[model samples]
Target: MTTPASHLMTSLRSGNATAPRLTWYGPDSERVELSGRVLDNWVAKTSNLLQDELDAAPGMRLKLDLPAHWKSMVWALAAWQVGLETVLDGADADFLVTAATDPVEGRYDAVIAVALPALAMRWPGTLPAGWVDYAAEVRSHGDVFMAHAEPDPAACAIRAGGGGVHSQAGLLEGFALPHEDGARIHLAAGDGLEGALAGALGAWQRDGSVVLTAPEVELTDHLLATERIHGN
Candidate 1:
């Protein structure tokens, strides 16, 4: 077995090749954060496919266009096996097609994305023409996925539910503050405008949940959900 020093040397020598990470995910997840959950799953799949990708091609990179709801610990490890970078390509296909235009972009011949069917339909050309259906493949994959890279970081989440959400004006003020200066924030106000803070604008390490009214982030209520009770 490799000793601690051996492992440390191995990691230090080729850290870039073995360091894992979650490049993208959703914002303001109430519990474990649905977006973070998907990220975790993706990491798992990538890790499982890492050796496979490596055996097929020694030096290659994987570029991902992940939806807001895609996060998996597995995806990160798998990336380290090769080199995977995460990118957020809005919620549309028009942009995605354009993203694969250049040679560097072309290098990302493979793709991992959610809503593959919808995306496939939107593509001007054909499905799997030069892309790998990430979500679809993941759904078909086994539940148990292993890792080959080191832990980048675990994701934590906080959300302000709609129970306290009320209408005064016509906008969504969101329920949580973006947190301290270094806080993670994803600002999104979708559908039900009565009151909803779509996401955070910073990273995913922010704490507590704060809910504002319809027109102002300042004029809102306060709430915190615990795992046992206050479940979403």
Candidate 2:
């Protein structure tokens, strides 16, 4: 299997276009982009962190709270960089608040959220804080991108849902495949489609591309009501 770095370098050399990647902002700001130099630096920093994690703990689960925007590609890639299974919860911060408390899905390391969507974030850690700015930290890292670890698919990835978390065989089945046409995006369940930077967008960004479903407004509204009623 070709490494992500080699694949990214090939795409960059070819000058491909990619979907935008998203990052959660402060409590007030909406999602923001982490492309260009910002993206380079993130890839550089997170790449090292991921390698360190793999070195310390070979099979640890990683949880990310991301939205469906082009910018989300960065975090997804970063997660894959460390071989962490990015739990795909098609809900927002409000939804996570309940998931975290529930007996089944409550053991996440961290979740990513932005603006109003962050209504689900009552949890805190290095990933998400009760009252903190993640973007500022990304900026503090600077413009140099660095890393040495390669993508290891043999590692575990768990997709958590209401009943219980399941093995991410769907991932091993192949989410991105190299084709004569180019990098192809594959998604089985509808949940994998959001903010997945695939096809043209991914090629340009030198990031993994995605073919995801559009966002759902009703779901977000439902999370809000649940949070309001439950007092999250």
Q: Which candidate number maximizes TM-score?
A: 2
Q: Model 2: per-residue lDDT, tens digit, 106-204? A: 433333333223333323433334322333233344333334443454544444344333232334223433332333242222244232433323333
The models' CA-based lDDT, in order, is 0.30, 0.37
All candidates' TM-scores? 0.35, 0.45
Mark the regions of model 2 whose C-alpha exceeds 4 Å error after superposition.
Answer: 13-42, 45-58, 90-132, 142-151, 157-173, 177-232
* TM-score, prediction 2: 0.45
Per-residue error for 32 in candidate 1, Å, reads 12
Backbone-clash count (model 1): 26
Give candidate 1 misplaced runs (Cα > 4 Å).
1-39, 50-60, 65-105, 108-130, 142-145, 149-186, 189-232
In angstroms, the error of model 1 at 121 is 13
